[model samples]
Target: MNQTRYPELAGKRVWITGSSSGIGAGMAKILAQQGCKLVLHYCRNETGVQQTLQTVAELGAEVEVVWGDFADYASLENVFHQAWSAFDGLDVLINNAGIVTKSTALNDNTGAAFNRTIAINLQAPYRLSTAFAKACIDAKQPGVIINNSSIHGQQTCEWFSAYAASKAGLDAMMKVMAVEWGPKGIRVNSLAPGVVPVERTAKILAEPKMAATWTKTMPLQRFGHVDDMGWATAFLISDSAAWMTGSVLTVDGGLIARGGYPARE
Candidate 1:
């Protein structure tokens, strides 16, 4: 509920994937306050999506909800189409749907898990961005695409090989898209957030020692909040960042700057 206004966002149409909860929901709420027409996407969490829709609606912004399975290419295509059709055009696309699974590179079954993770985290965003950009080009309208990546894309962490690889791929894709689409007035970028407490990370954040260890290493001495990511997303998509494209914005509370060092024990 930080009421910072972005006049540039007013009346814009935005599509956010995996917006039922977590960072996506946070972005929806913040964008709604900016008077943006929102197309909120959710895979299976109807309840969560409904809650998000209600929150945005209460904020008095035009909003709608849609569902799609990222693992299915056809479904993913339909998602982009439906989202774009929701407002007759999409001014921004937030590729926020992603998955992180616990897997080791040495595991024999890692290939399946890796492929699944990539399909959702990397391929889906790639396809969505491509479609959105093509549509913008056809319509002669400028657009923006923001991919929700992770600190794991650039930093190493154990048992997250598949997840890390997917995020890294996403970052690379964002850069490539920016270059290819920039001339058409389409901007593409990635936001890499670190250790935000959401339903997905609930169990990990519940561990006292683990939480303390992470908190101590961060120069900000805390994990990121959903609103932190939300506000950043809004800014990046706004006209204020018109010159920013093909860049990776890290919102990690200075965790990456610590160079993976542990707190002094």
Candidate 2:
């Protein structure tokens, strides 16, 4: 947690999906302050998207927003291309837009729930990373793609099979792309987050005993914060982490490190 700061990211072009709320909103605020031109993406949350753009504006960074459905890739292409045009080049892509659903197990999952969960959580990031990385490579520019995975990627909750599996798939893909794109000057990595306090997941935070149990459970003896995630992601996407790629950094409160991984085992 020795978070030193640097301004090497000033004037870079960055795109972040799922900027409407939660970790994405938090990261947008931090990255905007670091002097990056931002391309904010939202799937359906009009109010959340407005809030994110307002927050970015307050930071005084150059910002633009686009609307596209994660289930529809063609709708998203123009957003990135326009953002790339506006900024001249794209330097970073944060595939943070994902949806989580509570289905007891794959067996218990309704066909609709199962399909939607995988499409948004797993397929969205995979598709966007491919498009963004291809554009960067074709342009012969160096870039970074940070995928927002979850602690459930390595572990899992009983009813979170679809959600956890999606994240697991995302991390698995990150590993392959890191190797495939390394020589091409592109970096791809994923982050597995612990319980981060957020309005959407405030239901989880309201249960103090459960939250405490989770905290005392991790090796760090605490949960994580969105700001913590922001800093870790900022470092990974920055020049500071240039030597690292194909890495799945667990920003969990050492939850996976302490070893409760059954899903991945």
Candidate 3:
């Protein structure tokens, strides 16, 4: 179907990491709706990713599933090759795969824990973006890489230092690439989403006490949906945001608009 209102991503080759569930899955669906050819990259959730691929297939998208651990760089080339074999023309790369094990304080952070966090959230995306960028440049096609980032990248969290540091690096990397790849038609940016309620956060949000606390504390008094983040990403990576790059677009529900202090106990 020809898109009149939307930028018609039909046939545009799109590669997404962390696409098994949550915001990544949601964005995959939105991209499918726009007729994109999708490469869904998931970490360990094969059964779940197959389900996502089935749904995407139903949407008339050309779909391929690739499994590559974000912490393992050796397997990245395999993923790129597998997807590229089918669709040689790459257009978009969404670095959405990341991992965060909560630590309440820097003292709580072990060397192993910090290493794991940086490896997956920060280092892997940087490596993958480099890999994807090189491929797209070699193919001589304009590409867009949208990093799935967090609001914490812009602000500090009390107990989540590991997660914060990884995201901070991600934010810095995206900015550098916007300048490096812009000359080649590759736009690099990040979606610094606040709390998104989905499989990833559904259980936590469903906890009545936690939900109530955050709701009262959060300025918007509500949690954001994965679709909210996904749609914004769709726009940013599309021609609609053709002029946008190196930008950290926030989708928090007025969370960042107010003072950082939470509601008093």
Candidate 4:
């Protein structure tokens, strides 16, 4: 953690949404260590944001915090403005705010949950990235956008209709934006994580039986850690990936590669 993998990241201004806890928090910590000035956003996790603020501050990273409900939709532009104004301007925008809604296609006939999931997971990022890109273009500065997408975008299972659709849409939008904005020096990419246990899933995923069963399907035979996603995020925005854009980086321990087939007898 002490090593700075990307020295060029130092002094870069970054804004990360939904960074109060979980994978977002992990990404914040790593970016802070890389010497990036940060604008951390949260919806309702005040306490979680405080912890993130303190941790990053201790790491000597200049940081600020903003809050907004992505479901509100209309207010998202204001939220992005708040984050942008925090550091005068931002060099990177990490669209990581999303909700995972698991529901069968037939269970929720009303599609209320699906709409909510799309609003927060897909629509919000769309708006934010648009705003970020416009601002960067107006300022005539290069920028980077990293969408914290999911493996569900490429492949999914039952009870993930809404989650899968949102992520899939996100990936598609990311590619279009990368293509449209690449000429303007705005790079866009996505990180598709698989089975990274966070606070929300810690209890269930920690069970010996559940852990073993899930891990067995992965080629690497292990669940992903938050730090793993964090490191990948860093790399996506780093100089090492300077030529990378409009692509999805899958850090899933080969789960998707193993396919949906059952293990060998």
Candidate 5:
């Protein structure tokens, strides 16, 4: 795919969490092509993070990788601070690290799984966004924040209650942050993606029947690609979307509009 270089993004410092692989990695590559300096974060995927760094560097973009566990608040804070200082300052923050535990029932004996999900998906974003905003405000610099939300935030599937709740909370948080930070020249928004085939969803998509069902139900008759999400994210963080904030841009290939249409038997 041909890369669209956004002149406005050139030299802008960006920090993306969970960028070792999947959507975050895709966004990192795209932004790198746009000439943006990137600080990529990963939890434990050192190999994946290194691979992403190599890929971004090949695009002639300045990039750095940081490791942190979002489930730990103190670790998360340290990661953000290190990233903020990596490039002297940060112009954008992408809250993308999240976890979705399969077969997570609401009444499961232990609430451990549920708590971890909320902590990583919702709490991490909340804390990181506040830190990013406060730093921007203190420096009197304009900034952008994009939360990597999910279509599940609005529509739920079986066994995804905790994940959905976390995403929904994230969307709500974005709106509130936008309202409170917009006046300070900070923009906050959420990008709710549909079924994008990435490392995390490879198992689900490998199920022939399930994959076919998604294809049939989506109006576009196909699953979303990582680059598709990457491009949308890049646009949102760009000056082109200067007038937009507190909005949840759904990149779900018309799945939500279909309202869960039944797949052919």
Candidate 6:
């Protein structure tokens, strides 16, 4: 575990959604190192969440675990209440819970998968952020929101209709939330990561040809690590980004910056 650089964040309360694995788990670990009290959420994956809880606890964090199915939208309010009351109230809301539904538009003609993707990826964050913002306003306290977005929101390829739409909506809604909450001292922002290999993609992304193909398009010449996202999240919530809001912090290692041009010699 890394040492806490932002001592100011010590003792702050945070709720991280989908913390059972991947980027959410990474964020939980990082926030734990920062000495933040955490409310970790998971839809399922009890084992994974427990592992995350144990790891963060080992880092000396006061941690709690919660669960909710975002697809059942009506249940989110109660879930948010539970998380809020875990530590009295939360100081930060990391809307990191999402699904990556990759299917062609034709395959999703019924829009079931598309709707499900929107529900979990976009609607859940919207609902959760709204709850967090209201609670902060009622308590008359400043707050922060970090929406875990994707490069697909800005640029995309095929088989991402549902995924892209949800992320794009998230980014737009994040901006509006920032605008409305700015005067109230609640900051909203999106963290757009590109080509970060998590547990789900690590094996495939590690293949020599696959690794070379992806990294070649990125000027940084390497895939992103979960820790990179952890650092980025810390910065967003830290005083370092006090004045920043309604922004999309792109941590893509130049993947999007390079565009579709062929690799140069």
Cα-based TM-score, every candidate:
0.96, 0.90, 0.92, 0.98, 0.96, 0.99
In order, what lDDT does every prediction score? 0.91, 0.82, 0.83, 0.95, 0.90, 0.95
Runs of candidate 3 with Cα error greater than 4 angstroms are 1-5, 105-110, 262-265
lDDT of 3 by residue, 122-236 (tens): 8878877888889888887888999988988988667678899999889999999999999999999999888888776799788999999768867778988877876887788
Identify the superior model by TM-score, candidate 3 or candidate 5.
5
Write the residue-wise lDDT of candidate 6 on 105-142 in tens digits. Answer: 99989999999999999999999999999999999999
Ranking according to lDDT, highest score first: 6, 4, 1, 5, 3, 2
Error of 1 at 260 (Å): 1.9
Candidates 2 and 4 compared: the better one by TM-score is 4
Cα lDDT for residue 108, candidate 3: 64
lDDT: worst 10-residue window of model 4: 1-10
Q: Give the Cα-based TM-score of candidate 2 against the true structure.
A: 0.90
Distance from true location, Cα of 165 in model 1, Å: 0.7
- Give per-residue CA lDDT, model 2, range 1-265, as digits (tens): 1223648877888888889899998888888778778888887788998998998788777988877788765666676676577677789999898887887765664677777888888877777788888899889899899999998888886888778888999999999999999999999999888888787877876698987777667777666778888888888988789999988888887677767643221
lDDT over C-alpha atoms for residue 125 of model 4: 94
Question: Which lDDT value does model 3 have at 142?
Answer: 85
Model 6 TM-score relative to the real fold: 0.99
Q: Judge candidate 4 against the unseen true structure and give its global Cα lDDT, from 0 to 1.
A: 0.95
Looking at candidate 1, what is the lDDT of residue 153? Answer: 89
Clashing pairs in 1: none
For residue 175, what is the lDDT in candidate 1? Answer: 92
lDDT of 5: 0.90
Q: What is the lDDT, from 0 to 100, of the residue 111 in candidate 6?
A: 98
lDDT of 3 at 137: 84
Candidate 4: residue 22 Cα off by (Å): 0.7
